[model samples]
Target chain A: EPEVTQTPSHQVTQMGQEVILRCVPISNHLYFYWYRQILGQKVEFLVSFYNNEISEKSEIFDDQFSVERPDGSNFTLKIRSTKLEDSAMYFCASSEAALNTEAFFGQGTRLTVV
Target chain B: AQTVTQSQPEMSVQEAETVTLSCTYDTSENNYYLFWYKQPPSRQMILVIRQEAYKQQNATENRFSVNFQKAAKSFSLKISDSQLGDTAMYFCALRGNFGNEKLTFGTGTRLTIIP
Candidate 1:
């Protein structure tokens, strides 16, 4: 089955440095999303992207976070300044359509900021 | 704001036994979708099953089934003939059928299938 693929299964970055997590969603899907889960916490929605732009974002998706469909197949999340608290597992997901269809998730990128 | 609650933080079941994980959600919208996602040690979130709010008939996928109580706003997952491979973190999620709505996920239940 076709699946969303994320790069760098694990990443280690210095605090205050910039980091960009990349994802290649399923080719035919129209919607893309970025979510994060802190250790032992529930998954939190960060942002949703459609039509090459952000359609919605949560309060946790503040100034430091930005998502881009840099190309037809690549969706990327960039964090300008990483904080210690930013350490978590970041998941990328896509759906054929929004809301109605089930969203398929990638294996997730473990971001570790020290 | 919508929220999903998984009351049980952890649960264990003997191999080949049946186990049920509880999930309750709060949503104002009438039409929505509910899902159970399984995350193994690999950390890959896999969709186990889904239930549409408008449908009264519960959704089942193989040994994985759900008891969806629309009126009570409850959606629980039942895993029968549980195997050792079933050990994972299960999350119940909810999403409204409206525009640009993101999925809301529960804290998750850590399930262990003992051999």
Candidate 2:
């Protein structure tokens, strides 16, 4: 089965530094999303992208966070300046359709900020 | 704002038995979707089952099924003939029917299938 693939399964970054997490969604998927799970916390939606632009975002997705679909296959999330609280597991997901459709999730990228 | 609640923090079930994880949500929207996702120790989330609000008939996928009470704002997951592999963190999520694509997830329930 085709799946969403995320690179750098684990990443350790310094506080105040920048980090980029990459994901290659399923080729035919039209909607892409970025979600984060803090240790012992619920999975929180950060942002959603469609048509190469942000469709919606949550309060957690502030100015420091940005998502881009640089190419047909690559979707990336960039954090301008990482903080200690940024340490969490970031998940990438994609769906063939937006409404009433199931979204497949990637293995997730674990970001640890020191 | 919408929120999902999973009251059970941890639950254990013997192998070959059945287990149910409870979930409740607060949503004013009439049309929406509910989902149950399983995250193993590996941390990859797998969709176990989904239920659309408009569908009165419960959604069942093999041994995995859900009892979604729209009026009560409750959606619970039932795993029948539970196996050791069913051990994982189960999360209940909610999504509105409009153009909103964001999913609000519950705190999660840790399920252990003991042999």
Candidate 3:
């Protein structure tokens, strides 16, 4: 089965540094999303992207975060300056449609900020 | 806004036994979707099963089945003949049928199938 793939299974960055997390969604999927899960907490939606632009975003998705479909297959999330509280597991997901379709998730990229 | 609640934080069942994880959600939309996802120690999210809110018939996949009560806004996952491999953190998620592509997830329930 085709699955979403994320680069750098684990990443460690210093506070105030920048980090880019990349994902390659399923080829046919049109809707892409980014979610965050702090340790022992529920997964929270960060942003959703469709038609190469952000469709919606949550309050947690502030100025520090940005997502881009930089290419035909690559979706990337960039953090301008990482904070210690930014440490968490970041998941990239994609779906064939915006509604009534399962959003397949990647293995997740564990971001650790020191 | 939609909210999924998994009241049970942890549960354990003997191997080959049956286990049920409870989930309740609050949504004003009549048309939506519900899902059960499994995350093992590997920490990979796997979709175990899904159910459509409009459909009264529950969804089942092999040993995994769901008891969905639309009126009560409840969706629970039942794992029959559970094996050691069934041990994982189960998450109940909700998504609206229109205008929203994001999934609202519960806190998750840690299930252990003891040998």
- Among all windows of 10 consecutive residues in model 2 chain B, the one with the lowest summed lDDT is B95-104
Q: Which tens-of-lDDT digit does each residue in B3-112 have in candidate 1? A: 99999999999999999999999988889999999999998999999998989999999999999999899999999999999999999999986674799999999999
**Relative to the unseen true structure, what is the C-alpha lDDT of residue A94 in candidate 2, on a scale of 0 to 100?**
96
> Candidate 2 chain A — worst ten consecutive residues by lDDT sum?
A95-104
- Give the per-residue lDDT of model 1 (tens digit) for A9-82: 99999999999999999999999999999988889999999998888899999999999987699999999999
What's the C-alpha lDDT at position A103 in model 1?
A: 95
- Provide all candidates' interface root-mean-square deviations: 1.2, 0.8, 1.0
Report residue B94 deviation for candidate 2 (angstroms). Answer: 0.7
Q: What would you estimate as the lDDT of candidate 2?
A: 0.95
lDDT of 3 by residue, B1-103 (tens): 8999999999999999999999999998989999999999888889999999989999999999999999999999999999999999999999986677579
> Candidate 3 - CAPRI tier?
high
Q: Can you give the TM-score per candidate against the true fold? A: 0.99, 0.98, 0.99
**Residue runs of model 3 more than 4 Å from their true location after superposition:** none
Candidate numbers sorted by DockQ from highest down: 2, 3, 1
Off by over 4 Å in 1: none
Candidate 3, A1-114: lDDT as tens digits: 899999989999999999999999999999999999998888899999999899999999999999999879999999999999999999999999988789999999999999
Write down the DockQ of candidate 1.
0.83
